[model samples]
Target: MMGSRGTSAVLSRAARMRQKLQSSLEASALDIEDVSYQHAGHAAVKDNANETHFNIKVISPKFEGQSLVKRHRMVYDLLTDELNSGLHAISIVAKTPTESGS
Candidate 1:
């Protein structure tokens, strides 16, 4: 399925993030909102920057016993490549299924 791998290369950053988080976390629910436009004029943002900011909400069993900081760290760790690749900021709401009442 090398072609599928190639297809992923063309996905929007948000789509790639969604795929990564959903698969890695085994998330029951996942939402990824691109908020980059809100940072358009911020000093760190270049005129051509896209997918630099995001709001992410995820509910997963993997988070059940984890502390908030640990959950966030898990997410950050999963996205290290994205962070290194110009993804600047993320607002994350990491939750367990019970915590989210899902």
Candidate 2:
């Protein structure tokens, strides 16, 4: 008998990033925008690449005591796999909940 579990669902890059950040950072707010279209003609981006560029904004307690560089590093570390897998660039706006008036 075949099992009911057919093909597993694949998560989009933005969705995957959101899940990772939300779970790891306990973010009060999170936004991920795919900006690949803006870089369509850029030399580094291939013509067929879809989720190559992103703009991320996140506010979390995890960033409370971290410096700006540290916060950016934390975000980069979390998305290392994504970065390695054709995610070419990201503009991150990471902030503490307090800093964001949350």
Q: Per the 3 Å backbone cut-off, how many clashing residue pairs does candidate 2 have?
A: 0
> Model 1 scores what on Cα lDDT?
0.93
- List the pairs of residues colliding in candidate 2: none
Clashing pairs in 1: none
Point out the worst 10-residue segment of candidate 2 by lDDT: 1-10
lDDT of 1 by residue, 14-58 (tens): 988988899999999999999998888788877769899999999
Which candidate gets the maximum lDDT versus the true structure? 1
Off by more than 4 A, model 1? none
Clash tally for model 1? 0
Best by TM-score: 1
Worst 10 residues of 1 by lDDT: 1-10
